[model samples]
Target: MRSLITHLAALTPEQLSDLIAARPEALLPPEPATMAELAERLNAAPLIDVALLGLSRPELQIAEALAALGDGCDRAELAAALGVASDDADLDAALVRLGEVAVAWPDGDRLRTVPLGHVWPCPLGLGAPLSALLTEQRADDLRRIARRLGVPAGTQKAVTVRNLSAWLADGANVRKVSTTAPADTQELLHQLAWEGPYLDEPTYRYGRRTGPAQWAVEHGLIHVAAHWGAPLQMPCEVALALRGPDYRLPFDPAPPSAPTRPVDGESVERESASAAATALAGMVNLLEECGRTPVAPLKTGGVGVRELRRLAKTIGDSADHIRLWLELAMATGLLAPTEAGLLPTEEYDTWCDQQPAEQLTELLAGWLSSEGAPLHQPAGTGQPVPALVHTADGAAMPLLRAAVLRVTAGLPPGAAAADAQAVTTLARWRNPMLLDHLDDANGLVEGVWREAQLVGAVAHGAVTDLGRALATDQPEQLATVLDRLLPPAEETVLLQADLTAVVVGTPSRTLTVLLDAAADRETRGGASTWRFTPSSIRRALDAGSSETELLTALRDRAAGARVPQPLEYLISDTARRHGAILVRPVACCLRSDDPVLLKEILHARSLSTLGLALLAPTVVASTAPIAETLTALRNAGYAPVGEHPDGTVAVERPTRQRAVPLPRASDVVTAPLPLPGPYDPGALDELLAELFEDADESHPLSGYLIPTQPGPLATSEPADLARRLLRAAARRTSRR
Candidate 1:
């Protein structure tokens, strides 16, 4: 087979430019002046890795087997190596794709690739060739194999090795020698041939006694390879012959199709919308919690498992469920990291103002491209991968996620496959390079499924309409679908005598805020339940709600039913005792307009921390600082406000802090495989135009663009430009 450079040299200037345009400029040779340099750069390790990303499963399989076969192999030989038919259309297509990517080219009837021996050691788990292993074998063993093969056993070690290598090269000769082995030994040889062409010593107990391994070794069928990952290795030629006419292995050229069951489309929509609403509620709850008190991250820079569990308990949800919401919060910029911990960002307020459908649409967009893998755990480790830790830098999680969504989108509406493995298999087939880490693929696939379900992109294991919109990046379509599927919001609640209230559907923003102020949410889902408690009523009072206003609001939102007596009584009673005991910040001295109010504070035991001492009938003095006094009063259920030196109210605004936004989805390149330059179609043409321009003769770009050396044409003469143009034109005409 001819070298890749020789094949490249035959292409016209336009064809070569098109090929160069297919790759990024960064992957090409720097200032290449000849076809040889271009070939070298294209076949370089990094570029080859990138080119392989465009191949399908069968294409990649053929490439791997061809590289393993060494030198070059005919179509039949290549098919035999992969245990497939030579005339298979998939095989033919795979060869064409290899040529298109410049990973391999056709030479007569054989296919040749770049020298990949260094790139993939032992491709397809096949061992080193018999010729390469000859150097490591014992001299006596070599001579004995030569004598058994009816080849002259030369006295010198090198001569005997040379003679055996020639014999092993011929498939007919290798099969003839295999006839001496017993039937059991032949069976073992065939098994080794298809299954990695090697056997572990411990599994076979080869050197112990008269076994099949021993019989094969004595007949020159298998040999010891101590430096390999396995102990014993069968010669490449012998393995191919043992496979026989219809060489077959476990390789699957086509992707596995998952078995699916049908479901009702309406039911799927209902469930998915419900899940999406639940997910939205969970995120809102998380933001409110973070705003109230910034959560401290672990020493390792992520939320600890214990803290997440505690939050789960507080929110009445499982830890795993909460983890998904937390990740969504991070992904959408609702929450950001701070020096203190993780806090709700300013974006959270705006996000909360949007409708449920709009809110969910934004979340789905972020999730589709999010690098967060909350449900993915390291192998053998009980801990899950954490979010907001920036640990996913350079990882292909976003690419894998899109691939999984693509597979799900292919299923018929309201149809669900049996399990995630089918989706994983299909996804792996489409983007072979993205899921190259075989050990981590399963965990990532499972995590994508869990996240998609939690985000309402999937329901009953089938993709929803909103999910299809998300996958296609149609935001308007996503919003329309969600609005149609999501249940309408209710403006009222069912009040019970037991001081509990229930909303039959999602509550309107106005009613939701009202309930949050006066009641504690006990549970939330499709429907939400709230309990009216003394503490909850007190919270409403503390937030500046008057007793009359609270009562009127409750009455207006009671679903045309009268407010329960027990709930009304609880609220009235709590308001009555709310400010019976008032404490004020005693800045050196405490003064009040009423002498009786001062008297009440002086006698209260809880006010002892204020260190109050009477100075006059309307005044008291304290040794504690003003700030400390104010906190103590507030903690003791007292209404306290600081005063200025002029006796006016002191109003201070709290500082709003924000962290740097997380890496956006757009920032992550979709091609997870190592690709050269961000390809631009015009770069190659621009480069070529500059090469023959009547500009600076010593331009560096000319060296980068021209595949042929610019010898005498280096001058900026008119004839030089015309001549080069004519030459390029001739090359194009010849190709046509």
Candidate 2:
């Protein structure tokens, strides 16, 4: 296929046209149509042909077909013969030929076309030849035409051969030319050229408005018009005229070059000096206005060179004028140079203050009115006071006046004006005189007055005494005066009350006894220890005895008893020390209901170690059961006996008895007790003898005993019964 296309592309335009006209029907080798067998054909102008055919077709085919037909062959004639519209085409071959005709037309300002009369074989079969050729031209031109006709630009550009034939056959002008003038018409047009075959009104305007003449006004175009008119109406025009069409109106030019060298030294110095003097004059004037003094020298009745230089710098003036001003001020006795800076004396200050306000205004007005004066008010406004003034000699008038005031005012008390002037003229001032001197002048007398007032000097004046006495009385006045005179220290003192007791001496190690009557026997070592109950002390006193006596008795009672070492020491210490001390109250009483037990406890000289345990039952039984102790004892193989609901107990019994016999010095005895013999007269006699013996011994039970025994033999013969009982008891007791 590529080879076939390449071969076809290599063909002459005529051959290609013939091949296209043939229109092969199959991809394989095919037969060609006979030339005599003509197919229905379409014919039109080249413009319409090209619009329909597109640019990629063979141009020669189009031209050859048109040539084959006789002259004056047009789309209209061809469409008529084919029974279609004048602009329509019957065959694609005819459309391609028309495009070739349009391409051959000449290029010019107007849309060029060949007269249809130039073609052969009228396609419409008309006897007369077609008048003209119709063309669509470029797509853009077609669009413009459509837009002018109010048709939307989106309308397709392709025109049927019939349409072109009809449009051209009407004989209307088929071209457009813009008559608008160029923007630079006033300036010579150096160049000319055709711009477009298709144009719009906005595009024409854009071209005409080029150049600086249309530059925007906001870009710094100055208005030179005196009155608002055309020049003002179009300021941009003026700008453009000055800057030219291509010139950038808004561009700023480069800055002016500076001088290569400064002015001659002498001229520069003169200028500087002049400026300095002018500034100094201004300062002097300002000071006077502000009621300040100016500095001056004492020697020459003027400001010294150094002082003048200093003042000039301060007031932005030259040393020369400053010196002159200072000299005049000193001569006039208005300014004085002291240890402080140059200052106006009191007289000068007073004069300055008292000077009429109008005088200042007049001076200011006069200065401002002078020729070439810079201090004048603008035109059309009320006359204003001059901010500065200069004499014919360039001496600042205000400064001279201020300096004179300073010298005069600063004169010492009783000192002549001439003397003050001399002092100021001779003095060299290193500081500003105006403010310093004015302050000093007022401060001198004012300071003294302030001090006087502060010290109550006013109160002590002659009228005060008389007034005070008249207002009140002599006594009141004296008291008031004294109160005022006396210092606060002499008037009052703080009396502080000492409420807390503070011990100042070291404490002694004195023994103190704590008679805890609530302490039970378990807590006490033994009765031998001086363990007194709360009731014991009360009982002692109740029995007509003092605490000291009771304590002594206890001490003596425990003196020889065996007890714990700590317990003995505690008892002795408490008895010796606590007895004499004044205790608020001491009482003792039994906390149990067992009076018998209490009596038994009292009768004993000292309790045994196990005696406390035995007493526990009675104590518990008499009071409460002591549940905690009972539970503990029961768990330890001891049973509670006679326990009551109120936690009281009569006794506690060991749960089990020991199987072993008690140890004795003589022999080992393991046998249990034999049953007692039948009751008899001898048994009673024997028990009585044994009881008597046991009672006579110093033992635990010796104090409590009864001398009685049970027996029936007493009713029989007393001699026989006694004899029998004695024998029987002897026999029973002797058994081993």
Candidate 3:
């Protein structure tokens, strides 16, 4: 790059003109590009020529894929890999883009990338390595598909046609699961635009069953239900998130792992992965609790203090542990507030059902993409930390998180740079004139690192596989890299004599949730322990589980352990005691045709002790009250009668509920949240174009004499005129 400019600087006027004629694009960059300034982007993907930026993301991918396949690779191969029709005009257009200025060229019947393809290990600012993207398995698949498609030998587009035919015919068989916000969810999000910065639970009414708020809750579109009876309205903050400019649900791309580390790398890598798995497993366990019994939100909004404490006790961890894990779940849109209590959203449930590795990847992405600093505040600080939005200083946390990730993304794999140095270097590169509210770079980086670790994006002082994908903001590739490292999920558990069930690897969310309901987690790791307690078994029975469901869940998750007798006894006993207490509210009570039933109710445990002074063999006068006695009667299994003053049997019914009418269209606000400005490439593009345009298109300047502007006595000297016109023409020739 230095020499290209220096050589131009030294070229005599004659030589300059002649050199420009021989290789015009070299002197004048080909038109329409953003890549010249791509170096400034945080990811710093492999550098490419300015011209290459002219293509869209898809076009760039096509161009680069062709380059990877070598000169022998043809349009058929590229089109197949890219999943585009070989003869499609769009494909032709992309090919033409590569050919401009010899970045690629038509070689006989096949098209090949030239300087652009040859410039880097891969081209067009693609961070993916060729080895990863075009694996032997993939190439072999292409070949096999070609044979299946009956492509003729030596066919010009043989490889591509085969790949394309195969992908077209069988690709649908490959199921894809990704987080999505459906129409119902989107409508609920739309309501948040004008309704508020936050919905007031006590006063605000649910608009409709179909509205965004309800849909968001049902779908986990907003992690917390904010439900004031349950599933709270979408928060102003979550609404803002849903309104991101790029409306597609955020996803990390298929991963492309970085270069392997040298020395102690194997041990360090495993340790890092282990740490990530551990952290993620903790959050998942907490999430399992929410699924079991969602906690109600405080009247003020957010999880209540008492409820948080209860969760801590139940999880068998300290309150601090509860707060950290709970907030992290909320921050990641996996937990939300509800009238019933803070619980996992529908989105969380759907996500939880995915494979273990995918579950971790999704959480890591949410952790990185979150705009708030749930973990940034000092412990015991009076100020309540924002769940997942702007930081303490009001600067967008997403931007700060991105900055830190960028620094790590640029480091060599396994290299551990000082956090302060990374912060300082980032600050120097930051655009101070535009953004505001971020002054504590060191603090921001440190806090972000801590949160990153807890969310499993980083481990052992380095970015994990998921972290690198997240740091690069290439969510589409997370699966690619992570799949290689993901251990198979544990489908069952080991039951011991002590009623302890152990999981060997990444535990299935389904199994975990079921086990947590029927058992208590005693320890977590490769082989997590969950002891089946009597209370835990009762919890399962109380949750409306049939005995078979409980037995099946236990048997399936128990790997091959013989069902312990005590465990079976606990389940059976809990089932017996499960519905003994059935209470109902009514205006009146205390009569029954059956004398034995009334007597039984009066003597029932705690109930009779409370106040069932019998007035008659078939009737009881309660010093307690009708409602209290009614509850006691049910618990005692008496099913006593409630009678009106007229001696008629009484019945209770609830009022019918209806959806609230939505506000007038004029009243509902719909607006997008502001986002940080992306870097501009227009200026760099113009500079490259201006420096390279030819003085004239035809006739080598070395052979032909220069001509003055037509019909002018002398518009200017030939040399000066040539230079000025060259500059002017470039501005016009360069496409944006």
Candidate 4:
């Protein structure tokens, strides 16, 4: 961080101005204005939280592991404990995540979780205490030993014991662990490790009944620790010696990569986007139908088997295609779920109104704005791979998608490759295992077409105008490239003698409502066909359209083609029967023009509840009124007036209301995986200091840990030191 600050400080003012002006997100609070400001932000807790939430699960797990240990641990030991080979992708990924977040860093080939409790407040597991791993017995024995040595209690006692332990630890082996040795020896090591690395006694047995305590004392392997609240001490150097020569516990090698896939063009021609286009077209048509006659939602909130098959037949598509498109519509905000059923949301209408290019952008962008591919699954898999459901393969898909786009962007003009090539290329770069499951090969390939080629992001397997725009992150370029695919909105249709009208393409909202009102859509596609009928005409009148108004709208929208005679006749005929009788709601009134009918009604027992009143010989009225009165009168075997004011019977139409679409979700981008950068000397020094202090406080017995001592462990004569050096030189010259 300091080095970064220094580098930024040295940059020219003009360069800094350009940087701040170009990227607004960089200037946010905790934003660095200079090297000093950057350093301050690096230390801020809020910034750390921001980094933490972005971590992958393994990275977070590894971090918490370090937090629990509260110190540096060897790489090999971690690999052994995790049961992951050293070169395993997961371990690599975890290490990468830790480095990116700056939560852990390398210390002499070991990893040290830095800033301790601040970095991970809730650690995965707490490390065992030091005394449990070292001591053989209780503190009472250490007190007796102190008395025998005339070590008085207090600061003086602490110093005297510290000196003794330091002397005794000088040339001892503290971490000598043997797993394949005798059962008793292994048992002894297990007992000590399970107990935590601590010592509270002076005397000990090296094993269950070895009785090597005093012998070990004479050999300088164990001594009293008057400081650090423990009774025994094992020096740092000896602990390192106890670990195998290389120190780290080792891991097995990673499995070899599978043989390269053959470049078979057999599936090449099958990659045309007709299926995708049909799927999209069907998606729109199905949503519109669902809005018209919604089916019951499944108990699990998905389309039930009955509804699925019904929808599939309605759109003339397979069940899988229908399901895929239905889900895609919902995911892309083009449709939403309502109590009635799945329906085209308000966003659908707005989306329809958009130019084709813009709509394609929304479609493709929506494709990118998710975590998992619901439609992309391996063969024989029952569970759907929806967003937020993390799996090894599913998790890597986003990065894979991003990487391929980048690869395409880097390609030269007019240079292109098929899905097979792209998939093969990406697999080699990240994790080849991703392509091992062959269940979703078609889906994997289709994505390239529907998500990329169709959006103008890639053309002929090469990144083109819009692709360049997205790759370069230029909004205006994207718009410019997509303009070619956007369909212009129209408000007219062509009428035929068979009472059918064809809208060549999508029409404006007003025309769509009119068509929906007065005609039944027979076929939907690039060009949709609608048929006019008497019932459909009545539907128009029910939606507040008068007979005359309906005729005018039809003629105006008919592309100047005369309204079909059948359509006109159908409209007039429906209008003629539109209204014929009138009934006004009233509390109570009665008059009769026919004395016989009046007498019949007056003699009826059912009329007793109404308390029927007679105001004239020609009319009769009752307290029960309007709709309810009509039903009661009919049930009583009497016919009554319940027509509109125009003396015409009313035809009912379903009140269609568009549901509010869910808020437009932000487009998701797989943020680039962060790589470890060069660490500044100042930060390294601070971290090292903390690690050393932790080691000094407790003699770490972990095979993974290396403890620290403050001063020289022991003193020796010059002649002795010379002789030790000569023997070491002799050992070095000999064969292992």
Candidate 5:
């Protein structure tokens, strides 16, 4: 068969570029001078592993079927092996996907995959041939089996084994032998054929063997090799014949259809914007709370359970919901980690300054690229997988999330939306290989949908116009799309007699800021409700808001609506009660029986730094500390003497101190450590063999192997192969 380099060399420059662009994870160097160099880079083990992980279920299955066939096969032979028609559309598509990633390349009239022996030793779970397996059997035992099956008992052991293998390769002969075996023995053979080709050895004594296992083995149906231990191995040819025409492997390549419910386009758009606004408002509230009283992190790093629960109560959301939001904030750099706790970062200020559309986009983009699932954990491991915390198994989360969103975005325009089941099916079809690594694949997909909904990327199970724009990476169009879908922002609110304010629609930036500071938000949604409580009004006053300024700002926001009497009374009462006490900072007190003496000290310009102020005719206070004030008075040439708080004269004294270094510990000699021995070639070979023996090659990663020339695919004419290659390439380009 032709090498992958030769196959790639046949493509046009543009076609080659498209192929390379399709699989960036291969990490092939830029601009290869020759096809050989490019092919060599593509074949690197790590790069090949990455490419294999990207194949869809059908694509991977087809690749494995090709590998099992050993020598390459033509399209017709491949279709036959997979139990599908040669002209099937999905078959063609799967082949195209494999070809795009250079996993499978076109040979003369066939296709060949990279050498997969080092990876997948047993493709499709088929076992070794009888010829190799019988090496552990006694020659007498083989001759006895040959005689019972009516085969020639050749003197040579190898000759007898080869004849038995050829006889078993034919379906009719195998069926004839199966009819003579006991009913239980026949069932065991059929089970091993489809499920896998290995079975544990029965525990019967060597000379007193019984049961279906021994019957099958005695009939030459299964063989045990000494090197492979006690497990009996079924030859590949026997398993294929027993599988029959139905084909044991799953072969469907069509994308699953999602169940959708129709909704009004206008309603979806409106609800989507409302959800987006609510999300943003919640973020603002969380940040303000954090700024006021930042919670401490756990010793192991991450928010403690109690702290997260407290935040959930403060934010009026579930702990899980709060966790997701915190993760989003952390992911977008809005919330940063510090020694104290998670606090709003400088990026948050910039985010707040952006338009609503841009703000939502920033959050959605962060979610798309974040490393781990915030809600779901690995299968069988009940530990909670926190957001923003990296887990090795979660590396595929971003890719899986993006794939699900892409599928949603690909839906037809209008108010239609896909349910979880349909979305899950298509996502699995698109990334079967990746999903195989995840324990809770369904939960992970559902989590992505929930996260998208949180950020207003989808509404009522459908991708809104805004969501579509975000998923497609059309940031420039987000503002225009969101603007068209949402109603205009209102700059006014309705003031109620119950001391509550209600915003009828999206609030203007200025109105939002004013309400957030002066009133506490009671309910948030399409119309947010704010209540003016005593504490809230006092908080505004403490922030330097005069009663008159606060009233004027409220009336302006209220527009033509009359201000409620209770709200007016509450604001005035709170303002009147504020600052009633006269509190001042004073470090030293100057008391004198003569009023004129204290007056002279307050009027002294040389004592200006002391910040002296006369409280009464006989008492004066200074802002400076006691020592500094006394020194200033003495330097000003005043006959002032320091007095203690108890009315006694104070005296000063000085003492000297020093720190001495401790002596260093003595070092003692110790025996030298033994050196490592030299490497042994035989040991390395044995280790490699053992690793390959135990390796789980049944995984998707083990689906390619080098092909021999003159394989089944070479049966077709070269012209047919060229035509097929062109059609596949055209389809791939159109997809791009």
Candidate 6:
């Protein structure tokens, strides 16, 4: 100890302060030694400086010295001092030991001692026994005492006692004066005292003046000290202890237990869905109510701003909830949005009023019934049907059914008396038998039944009679029913012209004649300027006449009858360009081997020639006769080409190469052909044979044998011949 003191004396002021503070109790001798004797004993040799202290002591030795010093001071204070430079593990151990000492100390109060040369004060005033401070058995007695003093029961007795002691020490009489515990204890006491006052009430009364504090006091969780002037605050130590290790009061009550059985996962989910549906219904109801006028709901006289506000508040859910109900109502056609507001349309309202109650009930039953309820199951499923399951209202089903009926019903006639009777009869039957009646009356009710089917109101074969009756009574409605039940017409007369065209393709020409007569009669009578009405033209076309034929007939009829100019022009224009050009192959291949003859054939005296020209070499050897003609040809600028042997002459090539210039009669007379052979049948036949045999087989005219005719023929005759040839060829191909 003397060596330790000598070492401590050698430390710097900060080091000395730390050493003294760490273990103030250790600074004094346990058996009271004189200060001078202590100093003399500690002063052995020259002391080492604080900086050199670590050089002489090992780590363990230093730690031991520090720990020895700690024993004399308050454990917490010593631990804190040692922890200043200590590692985490050592610091943790020191802190734990300090905590034990703190808890075990009398009154659980913190100890304070002076540094190195000073005296320590006793922390436990009056040196109260530790057992008295922590007396557990006294809790009940303390609670009773608290109740008698008007403090809360289950109050922290230790804290109460501390407060009472403080008041007493302040010179106030504990029994006569009033006092409060610490802030925390006061709150706890208030809560305990006030809690019981309204325990049985349905609703809690909470306010600044009548809140938790007042409630706790009535329930007894706190106590008040008696000293009046000296309000004894609860000691931090005792109040902290009352809080417990878990930080909850031992007397804090648990929440009340639920009354219903726990819901299964499915049931919980269904309940949530039901809640959402009900909320949606409420929103719809509010919207409908807003739409009603004073005359509409006579009982209310008239709704006001207050009513609207109340309605809004009643359905005060998310905007989506309101929107959903509105959409459902619109889709079902129960309500329509108008300029005024959302209102039931006449069809919807009438349907609501007239719908069969039982049918409506069945429909709504499907919507509101919960899956959990046994009654919701079908009858054969072993569960008894509930006599009465809750619904939106008894009337809701009927209204909804009516709405469905109205939406599905086709356009009504002046009145559908038969349909009304049929519906009434169907509605009279109970559910199990209704389907039978409907099946029996299928012919009468097919249309209505089909309409219902479209909206999923009834199953197939369930309401056939109703559907048929609807169809018979309301044909227009049949369109809607048909649209639902059958495919649309595969072919429709999209345009009047298209229909007319079809009519024109008919085998008989009766329609065409009638249309032509109508036009002639109209023109003769001067009924109108136009030769034919669109209807007449259509009729003609539909009568098996093509558009071109119809227009041509109109024009011919008009001209012969001296029709108006506008009418003629209309008919002519319609007919002239109405059809495509017709072309065909011909049998007569009138090939020209002589250049002079080819030119003459191409360019004829009349404008009706149809034969093509070809070049051939002449057998004549003299150049003079041919050159004179050539000069005349070159002056005329006739185009020419090299020719083959066959008594054919090749014309001189012209400056501008073009299709061979067909000869005019003037050219034929001015440039006479130098005939190489006599004008004989055999020669002509031989020429024709050679030309036909030498022609390319692929040419359309190659198969034909040319006639040895001497001159030009009629244009129509040749064209007719071509058409005949084409027909014959087609027939032959078909046979092959």
Q: Pick the candidate with the highest lDDT.
A: 1
Alpha-carbon error at 575 in model 2, in Å? 99
| Residue 690, candidate 2: C-alpha displacement in angstroms | 99
TM-score of each: 0.62, 0.13, 0.46, 0.49, 0.64, 0.14
Q: How many pairs collide in each candidate, listed in order?
A: 0, 66, 42, 36, 6, 49
- For lDDT, candidate 3 versus 6, the one ahead is 3
What's the best-to-worst order under lDDT? Answer: 1, 5, 4, 3, 6, 2
lDDT of 6: 0.30
Candidate whose TM-score is highest: 5
Worst 10 residues of 1 by lDDT: 710-719
- lDDT (Cα atoms) of all candidates against the true structure: 0.68, 0.28, 0.48, 0.50, 0.66, 0.30
Candidate 1 residue lDDT tens string, 42-96: 6655457656755667777777777667656677877766666888787778787
Whichever of 2 and 3 has more TM-score, that candidate is 3
Q: Write the per-residue lDDT of candidate 4 for residues 1-736, one digit (tens) a residue.
A: 4443433344345433332222212233223323455334433443344345444345556666655444566777567545667677878777765654445655666776545466544343222222322244234444454454344423444444454444323323244323333565444333433332334454434521134334333233344443433444433333333433454322222322323323222232123222233434666667777777765576555666577778778767666555556555765777766777666777787776665455666765555433344445445767543322233354334434554465566554445655544544543333332343434544554554345553345555655555556555566776765554335545899888888989875556577778988898887656778888766775677556788999898898888847878778878887775432233455544443566776677678976777666656655667776666555655574534454545355445565556666644332112221111222111111121222233443332211122132222113322333243344434544644
Angstrom error of the Cα, residue 694, model 1: value is 40
lDDT of each residue in 1-736, candidate 5, tens digit only: 2388667757865566556544332221122334554566567565566667667778878887776665465777677777778888888888887887788876877878876655557778877655566666888888887888898878898888888877876767877788788898889988988776888764557653467878777778777765434777787667777777455556767666777767777787777877787777677667767766675677777776688789879878776777777777776777776666777776666676666656766676567656557776456767654445655645566667667767677777663555677788777777777777776788888878887777777788878777777656565687787666445567898988898999976676688778877899988667888999876776576556778999999999895956888989988987775543122224877766667767887888999988888888777888888778766765664535456677654433222111121111011111111001122111111111211233456633233211112122112222333344455646655798
Candidate 6 local Cα displacement, residue 22, angstroms: 43
Residue 233's lDDT within candidate 1 is: 77
Candidate 1, superposed: residue stretches over 4 Å from native:
1-42, 50-57, 69-119, 125-174, 177-238, 256-261, 314-316, 331-334, 346-372, 377-396, 410-414, 420-441, 466-584, 587-645, 650-655, 662-736
The candidate 6 region of ten consecutive residues with least summed lDDT is: 45-54
